[model samples]
Target: MFKENMHTKVGFEMNINKDDVTAPDVIALLQDHLKSMTLCSPPESIHALNTDRLRQPDVTLWSAREDGVLLGCGALKELNSRHGELKSMKTSPQHVRKGVAKRILHHIIEEAKRRGYQRLSLETGSVEAFLPARLLYEKAGFQYCEPFGDYNEDPNSLFMTLNMR
Candidate 1:
């Protein structure tokens, strides 16, 4: 349940559910997320997953909805027994700045902990358009780090990781 605030509706009740990445609305939002990423970084630097790839067994996608309205979504991909990666994370355009992403992020972190992941990592753009995302991760204790797993160094990309201990 979200607190009633200036940005949220009076009876804001958010449900973060494990999604299959097949719903039409979820697909549309993911498309928009990919489109927005293309505008900010080159194709090689873009890491947001498409619907098909997000359905892989190693990945889990969660969507946040309030009163049946989609607010945002995020994904976690297990890298190994002790590691995980933050994949696609996007807030609906109308719901941006309404604490949607933050809540989803918190949910992801808790899930990672529950899964016994020792670390959670992510790759995001390094451009100004990604400032808000970078700040959000930083606020959640994610520290800048080197590329992990199958990634390589790229000027247009920034990698971060949180030590779960």
Candidate 2:
């Protein structure tokens, strides 16, 4: 469960690692992430994965921490030999706007590239609460796209993808 060190704009050294999703802090953060989803979207529209689903064989979760404090987490789920889905991306409430997500997002993109994935996609809420997330993905070069995999056209969901090749 170890990746590499990322130095932030604020000069703090953050560590991104392959996470097991068992640590108390990581579990607590995940609970908050799931609870937040409920506030903005109905159960039917919420696609964020729970802890059990996150541990599935096809998914790889990563955690970002600085000086032993958990800052954020994200996951990549292999949809096929050449495509992947970004899931459960969340930054701790106290760590928002601190570059934690940017670093983790960068790491996921690099890992997808390393895995020879042709594309990386994600589904986020279409509401205002998700504007920042959409902006982050857009800044990373992800573009609006049709839903991939098991997802269908739903007004509540916004799908985006990045071509890795």
Candidate 3:
């Protein structure tokens, strides 16, 4: 029941919760993210996870809603006791540039810190269309880094990591 009234140009009552991923709005968001990723990267390089995968025990998913409108969603995947990864972060198309993604990202990073993770990392498409997302990560203190965990170097992918410790 975490709720915050975001006072921005598009001011909305943003509520963040670890809720069901099968919800209609959530499904739409995830589907849109997957479709967008596929458009920018090869199938083999698209790493966006499906709802079932995001529901795994190690992954904590949160959806942001504003007055019952799903604004965005993000997930923190525990990699180990001291590491975690950001996954499936997406904001509704209409909510873009309204601070929804930034709010969700801050929530995820705080959760990772609460879990005592020493590092938080993410993988995003290395394409022109993804520049905004990359800039968002950079603005949040994430720095370019080498591929981590099970990820490998791919020209279509970019890696970023934030030291939380």
Top TM-score prediction, candidate number: 2
lDDT of 2 by residue, 63-106 (tens): 99889899999999999999999998999999988888888999
Residue 104 local lDDT, model 1: 91
Q: Write the per-residue lDDT of candidate 1 for residues 1-165, one digit (tens) a residue.
A: 212233455566789999998889999999999999989898988889989999999999999998889999999999999999998999999999878998899899989999999999999999999999999899899999999999999999999999999
Model 3 lDDT per residue over 114-162, tens place: 9999999999988899899998898899999999999999999999999
Q: Per-residue error at 23 for model 1, in Å?
A: 0.9
Note each model's CA RMSD in angstroms. 2.9, 3.4, 3.2
- Candidate 3 overall Cα lDDT vs. reference? 0.90
In candidate 1, stretches whose alpha carbon ends up further than 4 angstroms from where it belongs are: 1-9
The per-residue C-alpha lDDT of model 1 at residue 81 equals 96
- On a 0 to 100 scale, what is the lDDT of residue 78 in model 2? 98
